[model samples]
Target: MGLRPAHPFLRRVPHSRGLRRLRRLTRRDPVQLLKQLPEQEQRARLLELLRADLQSNEEIADETWQMPSLTADGRTADLPGFNFQTRVCDLQILQGVSGEAMENLTKTCRLLFPLDGSSWMPCTADPRCLAERLAQEVFEFHAKGFAFDPKRSGAEWWVQIRDSGHSEEGIQFHWDTDEVAVERHGVNVHPHLSTVTYLTECGAPTLILQCRNSLRPSETAQVYGSLAGGTLSWPKLWKHLAFDGQLLHGTVPKALAKRLGDLPHRFTFSAFQAMPRWSPVSCHAGRFRTRFGRRRLLHEISCRLPHRSGDTTAGTLQLHWASKDAMLGPVEKGRKREMVSAGGGEKKGCLKGEIH
Candidate 1:
């Protein structure tokens, strides 16, 4: 079987990927070049724009999101039952994102991943889209060389919102887990990485457990629990956390989900990413070696096409971070355990820092 990428307009072409890219780049009109400035001037102007954006991006992040500038302790917290190491960070950087950005984001979420929606929402792979840009920055800075292949990557995002009023809808312990897609050449799949970007903070503390999904391809959910992982609470408005998607995790104890009487509505933006189309992940080793020889889906994200309802292949195609268009820089440090000082002293039982 061959690789079928998650793009409505993309198809596996039996040609030299390199040659195709060269042709696209060189097909430019020579007549236009004569009317424009020399190549050196173009290169210098491009660098100027990049440098200017990079400098202002941090300032914009501080003002726009209003997240704290806390630094991470840099210690990887060990999940008890699993072999993965997770680190937390404060991702406070973005420039030129207008105040309406959040409004646009929530609007998209409601349109795509409704509050009562059951199916995961797919994102169009536009380099200009906010979600695509943020995901690219996160993966580049935080993926830390995880075992991901650029060509086979898939992405899906969803949102979860709970009003401050008491409710019994808190999540229980679970893994993001794998499932089979219904596409023509569908296969088993799981998100290689999962992320949570807090849009608003309440008293809810997300308990990331020490368990990882070791179940077989056809296996069902397994029982999991332990105090070996870590607890993240008191999130800054825009704090971000990431970890192995397969690890067992949950937010707020069922009993306390409703009793945080003084907090704002809980809203979060989450994404499952880098999920290659295969089960038992090792299957990738053999598939990549044989199919399409050395071809790759390099232009997947940059090409914009008309979207179709029947195209379930809609997912992000992140441009390589090394490309000239990377807009945000890596966060300086992961957020440290936050301490809430009241009256005269720090709150006695704030969740301990996950740093080991």
Candidate 2:
């Protein structure tokens, strides 16, 4: 029997009676609630939503696409075409933590998982302690069916000092989420949702995206959005990794294509996304292994690829949480480097005591 792909939408919490009642009480239409944000925020949120949806659909298509791999022994490897690669894959489910909790977690992650090198936090509140606290809070919230205000929450969050802008040699990020690529007369119907955020704003590298199969340098590669004061959220988290550059091909419709051809510039907008990293732990005979370690291994795997970067900013942080029933295809045996830039870069060991 051939392996099948799992639909990420199935994991979504449907609009049950209790959920609808809660939404009514909160006056938050989870589907159309994004319009309530500021104009810039609204655009960013919409872009993310569309990008995620498109990416999911693409993944479904790719999984079903007939592109089996041939092994060294001439055997057929049942899988989709090797089109996209994950720059980073980190996954975590935030429970009791408010938006503030997620902020603090991001800070901790930047400190703990620097691309340039490792840096230590002065405080005792490390990743493990924070994860435990978040888990407990999430459990409580799930049990009680209530939402906490991240801004007003009286939680003591540790904030990392960040630069106002990127350094000349900034980091880069690229990704694809699932969506339909049928562009109309002139509109670019982005089918997936993907995001890239910069940690060290100083010398932050500009973003660049293009069609995966474009022969020339790029017809549509330029920088987009800033992560300084933005937040991005989709209907759910799993939707983030459903598509990539492959589906991005032929995604832009004629109208936007004309504008893009005329302007030939990246879309600079304000956006925010919560990139949560979780640790997968296992214990056998009292010995333990953390997902962080597994991720490091994955990073090492990426490091070995032929397409490596001399600049330390080239690395990406991947986060994911695997469920037993998730229908992930077999792990192919070779390096598959992603051509897109999904996340921003970080300066090595250059944490300033305070932002200037």
Candidate 3:
């Protein structure tokens, strides 16, 4: 037969009067309704609507590219007074890919991260494969090989989607510590080299700081001295930036906000490679170990900071963290606190005093 006609029943479902009325009532102006809500509520509703739209049109990239092989040593000379080199390069990692494909990947990643879950969202790529690809590239360029501990390491690619307009504060200036890394990965290991690849047009320029002293645990060691620092930004395509993770780094909020405003979206694919454990230079200089001979674990410590908004001073809460219990005092302006035993030995006394 050349063609077939559709049956009457298959053509359309007749709507009842009640269903028609319900549809009409539900078709109100979403923007007007959003305007009636508070700013926070408006944002929440908009995000929910955006998520629904993204979920319906989710597309995963099936195309794979050959991992680039290192031809010549691409490591940069270490900066003066710094143990590691901060490297930036434009790679053809996503070469032959289209703008539309990259956009889809970014949206998929953003949808993967549940709003209530951790900031990190796992990548669709095989962790081992991605790790190996990165290790080869890093070795070829920086002469640094990642310490791949699959059993106890969470060293894999991830994505971070940030809405700069809604972000309370830009990421504060901070250095990477093994304590945080261990919390992410089960092992007490920190990334020697951190790589960032932008998957969307909206991108932020990272600020890298060079301090006067090595960031080790010492009575005289300050959290940061800011001997020197510079901003690094790259195109949204296939370019990548690699840096010494231990060095203090943060984003330029103004620049990031501009990018986000221009594109209305921002996200990146990032990977962290733990330093080779056997290397003497890889040790975090006792930063990962505590005074009590216990392994330093990550602990969040919040403190009140003298926040100044232009000419006015507005008191604001700030968050600091200690690698271990003993370090909390220094992190929180000499605030003395006791670590009650995990057992019920001092339950009554603990209730009488604040824990932090």
Top lDDT model: 1
Our model 3 lands, by Cα RMSD against the true structure, at 19.2
Compared with the true structure, all predictions reach lDDT values of 0.32, 0.24, 0.31
Clash count per candidate: 3, 54, 0
Error of 1 at 353 (Å): 24
| TM-score, every prediction | 0.42, 0.22, 0.39
Indicate the TM-score of model 3.
Answer: 0.39
- For residues 225-285, write the lDDT of model 1, one tens digit per residue: 2223233333335556666665545444223322212222343333332311211121211
lDDT of 3 by residue, 1-356 (tens): 00001010010112222222223534433333444689998677557655654455443221331212221221212223332554445343445665564444444344333321111112122322222233234333433243322222222333455443333223333443333322333332224455555544443334343422132334224332213223234224444556665444444343223421232224333332221111112222111111111223222222111111112111011112222311322233344664322111110111111122
Kindly report which residue stretches of model 1 are placed more than 4 angstroms away from their true locations once superposed.
1-84, 92-96, 115-124, 144-148, 166-169, 181-189, 217-227, 253-356
For candidate 2, report its TM-score.
0.22
Candidate ranking (TM-score, best to worst): 1, 3, 2
Worst 10 residues of 1 by lDDT: 285-294
